[model samples]
Structure formats: C-alpha cells, structure tokens
Target: MAAKPQLPPTTVFLLKTRSSPTDAYEDLFKAPNDAGSRYAPIFVPVLEHRFVDDGLAQIDSLLTRRQITNGRLQSSTGGKYGGMIFTSQRAVEAFKKVVDGRHASTRENATSSWPSLQDVPIYSVGPATTRALRAIKLEPPLQVSGEHTGNGEDLAHYIQEDYAGWKRPPPTATDGTASTDAERPGPKTDAQAAPLLPLLFVVGEQRRDIIPRVLMGDASESGPPHIGVDEIVVYGTGVMPSFAEDFERKLNETLGSAVRWVVVFSPTGCDSMLKALGLLDPETGRAKDLANRPRTDFIATIGPTTRAYLNDTFGFNPDVCADEPSPEGVMRGINHFMAAWTASQ
Candidate 1:
C-alpha cells in the first residue's frame, strides 16, 4: 500500500465580504446557524450596552409602524422559520454597508498606537494594511501573501512554522545572571537560520483604521508596544480593478525588490477560479495542487462592498478566514500568509 500523503498545516487568509446594512445584520445574526455550532458569530452591537433596554423598545415600535420588515429590520428572526437564511451573494452585500458605516464613524475617534519599526520585523496581509503600518514609519520585513486561504488561524500557524527553524541572536551576558531570548531558540539549519524581525500581519479591510489605532496605542507607552507587526498586508476591499492594479503598481515601486510579494484583487469566486485554473485541489480542498501560483503577495479590495460580496458568495467565515479589527483575531489571517511567504522563500 502507498504511504498516505501528509496534510499541510493551516494558513489564514483574510477575506472581505461586501454587503448592505440590512443584509449585514441578517448575516451576523444568521452566521451562527449558517456556520453551525462549530463557529461563533460576533458583532459590535449598534446600540450601546447602556441603551439596550430602550433601544430594543424603540426598534419594536419601528417594526410595528411599517418602518421595518423582516428584511428591513435586519432581524434574524423576523420572518417565519426565522426568515430565510441569507445565503445569496447579493444579500450578504447588504450587511457590508452597516459594517463600513460603523467603521468610518469609529475611525474618526481612533488613533495610532504602534512603535517605530527601527528594530521591528513587519508582516502584512494586504497593501492597505502595509500602508497603515508604513504611516507609523515601520518597514515591512517581508511581502504580503496574495492568495486568500480563509482566516487568521491559518495565518498564525503559517508564521509560527515559516519562522520556526530560524536561529535566534546569541544571548547577551549581563551582571552574572544569564538571560535568553524568549521568542524562540536557534535555527535548525544554515538555510533556515535568519534574523527574526518583528512580525506583523494585517488581515482585514478595516486594517486602515485598525493599524493606526494600534500604532497610536503602542506609541503612547514608554516601552515598545505589546502588539506590533514587522509588515502589514491587506486581504479584502471593493473599489475597482483599475484602482487595485494602480495600487499594486505603486506598492511594488515603494517596496522595490527588497521583498517577495503579490496582490490579490476582486477575489470574488476566487476559489472557483483557483479550481478552474488547477491551482487548488477540489478533492482535498487545498491549494497545494496549485504549484504554479505566486508565493509572496499582497491583496487589496476596491471597496468594502466587493469584499462583502466575495465573503457571502464564497461563504467565507470572517472569524476564521478574515481578521477582525479587535486585538483578539485582527492579524490572525495575515500571520498565516507571512508563514507561507517565508516557506516559499
């Protein structure tokens, strides 16, 4: 009997789903059921915790006044049988509008908190994420991973492995006491031995807003920021093909040949495209079959709506596939991309 092939480690790919206000709410509510019990869906409620009591009452009044419907209320349980689950690509788009609107409002009140990149290694998810990181004066150590693998968990795993075999700098002796680097030990081989820079991976469209806030938070303190990226890359947006292309060209010029990278744009139905191109193995649900694919890369979306569209159409899970701006899972997917890029290099 032939030996069984080993499965590849997980890599995170951040995805953006474009949707309208109504549709986004519906999706958020229904995501729990749609994704089954394995994944938990979370959303920043529009109403503040303090206002929850009155807010719900007002919402009910609006519903009774014909001001809202099962579709208009953005309610997951508004219709019979809890209304139809929003599975259509178009319906998912309705939700993006709400999320984007909220993001814009929050950005106005946000600030950057990252430290200077003089000694930090950066990881990025897409071009926009890189831009945000650059605004804080940090240089990216590597290129963004272009292919969308689906979420941040995969990205984190990839980074851990890609830089796994790297050798750490020799420990400096101090005052009779020995101190060792806490990040990782020495590299496994000469080929794998390389200096480890600060790693940063940008995972979502909101990275533009999130990066600055993170940088600002980092800079406010005396010591280096607890959370920082050596590089940043974006995964999802929905502007236009021309815009994406132009952005890619500009980024290439900025980074020059110092790093390896690629940009993914308008990746709507990209899984199908990859399958069609033979870049992915449909049978195994993996991209290993796509040997001809680019290695290190950055992806950008023309607009928020486009990202939402791809998410809905592809049924991509934002929790696992896309990075949320919150500290918890924000850069998770981008980290996976960095791992893949490092391995390819």
Candidate 2:
C-alpha cells in the first residue's frame, strides 16, 4: 500500500483589494493531494484599500455647482456635456454616493454632471463597471450601446471612433429610448445650440490618461482642438507603509521559508507589493526590479494590462494572466499553472 506524501507548506502572497480573486486562490490552495499541490503553500494577504480622503467633499462641490435652479439644471461648464467616461467601479460608486445622497457615510467619492443630462451617453471600461452603472438605475440594466471592452486601449479607440465627430445625438437613454413607456424626449441635435462641450471623465486618483491621451491627441499640442476633457477625481489610492508584521513573521517561522506563488491585480499594485516586501529598495527604486527574488516562484496577474507592466517594467513574464479578468478566469489561470507546474515537478 502506498503512503500519503507529507510535505512542508509553501508560502503564497496575494496583493489585491476587495472584490478581487483572493478567495479563489484560497480555495485552490486548500487541497494538498493534487499533483504539485504538495508544494501548495499557505496564502497570505497583504492587500488593503487605500484611505479615501476628501472624496465626499469634492463630490459635494461638484453637486453644488450642478445645482438644480428652478426645474432645469445648470452645470459649472455652462453647456451640455458630450458624454461621460468611467474606468473603475470606484468612480461609479463615488458618483453613487452623491447621486444617492450618502455623503455623510463616505470619505472618498465620484462626480456627477447633472441628472437632467441623463440624455448624454455614458461609457464604462469593465463588466463590473457596467454592473455599477446598472446599480445606479441609469436606465437599462446593461451596457447600453457600446461593446464590453475589457482593455483600456480598446475603450479609448471606441470612444474616439464613436464620439470624435460629435455628430448625431449620442443616444438618449442607455437602454435605447428608456425601458419604460414614458415617451422620453429626443436627444439634442442642434449643433449651433451647443459647442460640443467636453466629456466628463469620472475617475479615481490612481487613473491613467490612456483615453484622453489617445482621443484628444498630443498633450503638448495647443489651440481650439485642445479637447474639452473635464476630469473629476473621485477616489484616492495609496500603499500601506509596510507589509504586515504577521505576514513577515509567518514567512520566517520555518527555516528558509520563501514565497512559491504571488497573485497581483494591477501593475501598480505589483510594484507596490514588491516595495512593501522590501524585495525592491524603498530608497533609489531599482531599474531592474525583483532581481533579488528566487527564479522558481510563480506569479499570476489578473489581466493583460497588469501582465504588460510586469513584462515591461520588471522583465518578468507572469506564469499566468487571466484571460477573462474575472474570478473564474483567475481560477482557470491557477489551474493551468498547476498543470504545467506539476508536470515540471
């Protein structure tokens, strides 16, 4: 009769915020009988949400400027908006805080153009973001007109293709003329009435200017086509001052303990975690980061964007990058990693 092979547990690091795939990783590491699972380590979480400061105050200011005078709403820009862009659910929730009137409870938040400007188009980057829009009861419960673009570059290109000309009404209701039989009015098509007002980008503090940079052209360029881009910072992001003492302690519990796997959600978070773990110097950051870490360990990135960062910045191609950018997708990546890792072992 064959005996069960008992082995020391491996240590795994996971850097992600709420709603990430941390749980999936936890479940995968629970069983030690699977091939290569013998080396499956105990998972440790070092990720935490950054302190969201001055978010509600900023939202209130935008709300104040968008005061509903009489029955009509007047915006700070003094014209109709071309459209709206949202890259993160954090931006959506910030707008939710103000629109839903939850200012007293939240610290960080998003911005709003005007309830009357509901006729304008709203674009989102991810499926979670699409769900956030539907949660706000923004009209139809789906993404409305555009395709669900998971990539930021794709989203930027789509916006440029759809709204660059600023022709035709930018679709009144998100669900195609409102779901109810309320007989919604038509979109404003009179070009002379409005000067193709800038689009409102509801974003967080850690945002990348991919959309604006791509659609509006060179940042250094000057003159009329400078493009009207009104950016509203709704949420804040920052890393922990240091990694958790408990995590460090666990790593040192056994002789020569080391991380066997790591899961990162973003490129920023990936570098941030390396810094937190002292793998990269805090002072004079390294040009070739993660050089000191062992080569045998595996890293799993949440999506292609983050994987690109790892490839470009650290010269480290992650062992796996989730194809769909979802919890299930992440699990699939882990499964694939296990299959290959098991074969190698």
lDDT, candidate 2, 212-247, per-residue tens: 787677534243243456677777765544545545
TM-score of each: 0.22, 0.60
* TM-score for candidate 1, residues paired by index: 0.22
Candidate topping lDDT: 2
Q: Which portions of model 2 miss their true places by more than 4 Å?
A: 1-13, 20-78, 102-118, 137-147, 163-195, 218-227, 242-260, 269-296, 311-315
Q: Estimate the overall C-alpha local distance difference test score of candidate 1.
A: 0.32
lDDT of 2: 0.57
RMSD of each: 24.0, 8.5
lDDT of each: 0.32, 0.57
**In candidate 1, what are the lDDT values of residues 178-244, reduced to their tens digit?**
2343445774332222122233222233323433344324333253233323222222333333433
